[model samples]
Target chain A: MDSAAADRPPLLEVEHVSFRYGPLPVLTDVSLAIREGDFLAIIGPNGSGKTTLLKIILGLLKPESGRILFQGRDIASGGVRPKIGYIPQKATHFDPLFPASVREVVSMAFQASKRGLSRRQGEEAAIRRALEVVGMAEAMDRRIGRLSGGQQQRVFIARAIVDKPRALFLDEPTTGVDAGTQDLFYELLDRLNKREGLTIALITHDIGIVDRHITQVACLNQRLVYHGSHAEFCRSDTLKEMLAGGHHLVSHVH
Target chain B: MGAFLTYSFLQRALGAGLFISLACAVLGVFLILRKDAMIGDGLAHITFAGVALGLFLRMMPLAVALVFSIAASLGIMKLKERAGLYGDTAIAIVSSSGLALGLILATLSRNPGVALLNYLFGEILAIDTVEVVLSVALAAAVVAVIAVNYRKLMFMTFDRESAQVAGVRVRRLDALITVLTSVTIVLGMKVVGILLVSALIVIPAAAGLLRASSFKKAILLACGVATASVAAGLAAAFALDLPASGTIVLVNLILFGVLAARRTPRA
Candidate 1:
């Protein structure tokens, strides 16, 4: 609850990162910093390398140059990826009959944690707590394939938070989800951020509503177009043009 | 029935059938979940060529086939990931090339016509005690790996990206599964034959899918169904003088039909 530490060394620092897929550069010298308890929304147009940037930050993809520092330690130096969590874009490739329950899916997040294999009491407790946080505790026993899109999204969010990560990365978590559910989802995320002081980074095409909900914004298009408070991002010309191109933003008001 | 049961060869055949059924049933669950069912068939064909080559060289065919199939599995995985090719396409390409290479080698070594037929359709009736022990050992190794890495494998199968993000080492786990699949295929080919081995891998898992909820339950059900199918099929094949592989496949198909019918809604 020390707001003064916001200006101290950022919890995550990306220094001059660049990445290329063969010849085409998807990210170019992009740099940004995320402090503790920050809800940072990354917004940009299609092909803007928004997802690419997130991958680099998550250490899923390595940069061609520069380094990513997590808690002032270089991520490449065997810095144990702190309990970082992720909710991927809605997977269209999965079969509807893939047999797994919501609780089973969420419990998998603990597989790589210190808990190891076979769900123990501690892992179950964590899964229950995460589901409760996402308002999905009631539907824990439901088949994942049978859930609504928004409900499924919430289940994945619960899975991501089951490990109680210090940082959480979500890729278009609200896409295809209903407006009401999306509102509820963000509200739950806000609660987690405020209550647990969890840092959050989310990528979305919607720029309009993001400003109202997120503490900071990082507008990307193969580069860091802008990175500042929500107000500064809304006032910037780059974000305005990007949002004007028919990209729906997550509105602050329900 | 008494005469067949009294024969040592028949007993060995039954034992082989049981071991194969158990191993394939377990591995088949993951294959079905991962949607790589066809890869099993493709690799089986590739293993056929290995058996043919082994016959030509007068070596233990299963050992050679295991090495060949494992190599093919690795080759298929590498091609898919590194070249960005569709998984089925990669498997198809490798399978055909392996078959062609195997044929050329067998022809050059002048293997007998009976040896070729045995490799293609299997000769479970001729299974030896050594073959049974080898099959059981391979199956045990696969079961242990699955037990130890169950959680990680489940996470990877459901969501590879999330598993990677959580530091589960997705690629390593995938490679291990592929290798294990190769081992299973090689063992399977000994009893089911190269041409029909994949049926064992697909049918049992598909049957389990009809009713099971959790993956663990599905796999357990698959193993039970598969073992039953093998036992019934072997008995029917012995009684009717039919080919063991064909009988086993028919039994699996019948079981699947019964389960599917039971689960279907009345229109």
Candidate 2:
């Protein structure tokens, strides 16, 4: 997998990205590459800048010094933004009283992806296909806040994927989900990665997700601790000691 | 009913009220959903400062109010974006200072007490042709901006970060909404008064979102509720010989109460 990934130019590259809040540094010269069709899990301990790094890559924040390149083009120059979908960390933390149907929320991604005087051409079909992929077709007309936590996350995933993004980034998608639902969520992500060949980068504290679903692993601690195949990550004695030491990694059981 | 149609002042008040209601209700839905509802209230306070400053200078109060509130609204947005202050905290800081400034200005401009009271509580029946024309123009602008940016605004209101990732130009839209809201609040001052103007913005939207199944329905229902309440409140105020702003706000509160009662069982 490493050789294969190396053979193809990386789909997304984060080079020497550093960020700070006020005077205190949050990320210190961190860099990693995400290849096409690679299901990479970014794991780190609390305050490890895992989320901040993802925000920079997604263009939510400006890096102090580094740059992000998508398909070998600097995204800052800004022609067509790399078709990427994001489910933010506070995705499910939206106001419960917000009145929006599942279909409307999904369709918003389609409308929002386009500029000015949006024509609703193919919008319904796109929303339906996205919902069907997320196994949420049955709840298309239901209010999003009426759904359970895991189901809401699935709807958000549908929203992210409705525009048919080349790569998907999710920040802590299953933070409040139940144990049983977490398994199903991971299964859905696995299907997206394997069956649909969608590239996925996820920020998680769950070490278990790396073993179960991720093909590639990028461990971060305000820096790129490791970025390689899941097998290499598991076998590396140095990383295992670092994980056991609880300095750079925090693993959640369920 | 014939008198309502015949009185020129009543016609002007109704004309301005309906437009103001439509603008407020539509803008209110986005503000309510974004949890930035207090912004209308905040801008209303700033409008008070504007009015007081204008009166002290012996100038057109509404124009001064519009400019002052717009600048203050942008300041609030900057504080939230750059200073990392929470929305309510920023609103509170700006709004309290506005109220204080208005009080000082009112004191300095002494004996404009009757004119100040007219603005504080609203004298809708006394609305003139110019105020009515200004209301129509500003309300039209508000509707146009919202209609043009409807999709982006909905996406942003639902989830700001995801909308940003989708390249929605969220900050620009945020500024647009804030400026539009400031304009709406300033226009509302004549119909509902500076003190109760936000009620016209919030109560109807709250009622609409309480029962709406879709975003479109929420907006439509809010507009419906706002317009209906203004019409009813005007007639009731004329009959009861009460203050127009208070009556209009009461009518909105009643409608919201009814909707809440109907919704509580289902929730």
Candidate 3:
């Protein structure tokens, strides 16, 4: 709310969202707003609907009730989903022998997200720029599986950004990365947010993300316990109570 | 052997076998990556029963196999969805039953004992012009489908959940892949026999993955290896008086061995 970019219309809107598996309510009455240029971190313990909320925002899962709007249009109305970049939390490995270069892998996403043959000349340039942003341009032809976990995540980020999305969503981006790499990852995200003005929604239980790197924070324990500026979240009693209750599930430094 | 090229049966057999090999390799890389390699085995098992059913009914066995394989492919997907069965488990359920039915039909049929063998272990020399034409058409269709949906398929294969979020129709594309692979399996059965046909689908793709650095190159190399194997195997059989299907599978195995060398991490 303190950022200069807050004057613009909100890029994503979620209202009264609720979802559940057969008998268990996973996310109940979840609601939040993400504006342009916001570096919002959705923080929660495992199975706290962090991933489920991200998926619903990404339009991969339909909330049992309520709705998500991207740029003020219903996400279910379609066509806007592609403009949102997503980095999944689940670590599904492609076989080490599966033949796909970083460029090819990104191209698959680029082509699918764009609905074109990708013969356009600028498409490659855009792809190159995206990879360059992630420091992967130099190794675009390397087999994706051969890269280190951090590098693979970078490539995945580049894949998401190739379309120059209005907002980026990441689910546990540093789940498998080492501490050193985690620092570098946040630095890259900071650059993307501050320098490029790209909106970001990062899902992590790691309240460890340096306070300066995040503009806003939403605390969740199957419900939105807090949604406000990072400064306010740092001062909240809700953070203390949630951490006290779910401290066992949170393994990261806060 | 050169004079044998003048025989219409030999020419038809070569053409049909090579086309089928190309198609199988096209579908194989995706199948192998998806860990659905046994779909080939499963479909082939169903294809055997289809052939037997066709023979018993005095009809086109290839058509019967096509219907049977397609149904089995969809059935496997449905079973995996509804029964929460692993991909291979569903395949095993349908495939074992397919083999049993095929065996019972083979026992009751009036054809020569070798007729069942002919379907199980392909006799390339026996391929007629009609089968050749059908295979050619099916191969083209398979290649076209892959071409039109190449990006979507790759995205799904590499990351199904992410692709779904990107608005790609993951379910439809998965069903399409299963159906295409099923048809490829049926057509391939006539070239490599039901027993070894998965080889034509799986091995070339495996080799291609080992040697190639990109998906496009992997698919291209897979098709190339499969086509070359069929040609080499057919020629080797013609020269050595061997069964052409088994020779083709041998050629594929040898190619896989050579290509696998490159897959090791370099020091």
What are the runs in model 3 whose C-alpha is more than 4 Å off?
A1-6, A78-82, A113-118, A243-254, B1-4, B261-267
The 10 consecutive residues of candidate 3 chain B with the worst lDDT sum are: B258-267
DockQ class, candidate 2: medium
lDDT tens readout by residue for model 2, B1-267: 887678888889889999999999999999998888999888899999999999999999998999999999999999998889865999999999999999999999987788999888888889999889989989988998898888888999999888888988988998999999999999889898899999999999999999987888898999999998999999899889988889999999999998888885222
Docking class of 1: medium
Tell how far residue B258 is off in model 3, in angstroms.
2.4
Docking class of 3: medium
What is the C-alpha lDDT profile of model 1 across B78-197, one tens digit per residue? 999999996589988989988888788778877558877886787888888888788777888887888788888888888888888888898898899899999988888888888888
Which of candidates 1 and 3 reaches a greater DockQ? 3
The chain A TM-scores for the candidates, taken one by one, are: 0.89, 0.93, 0.91
- What are the per-model DockQ values? 0.50, 0.54, 0.57
Cα miss at A157, model 3 (Å)? Answer: 0.9
Alpha carbon lDDT of each predicted model:
0.82, 0.88, 0.84
In candidate 1, stretches whose alpha carbon ends up further than 4 angstroms from where it belongs are A1-5, A91-93, A114-117, A234-254, B1-7, B264-267
**Higher-ranked by lDDT: 1 or 3:** 3
Q: List the residue pairs that clash in candidate 3.
A: B122-B193
Worst 10 residues of 3 chain A by lDDT: A245-254
Number of backbone collisions per candidate: 5, 0, 1
Badly placed stretches (over 4 Å) of model 2 are A22-25, A115-119, A246-254, B81-87, B264-267
**Clash number for candidate 1:** 5
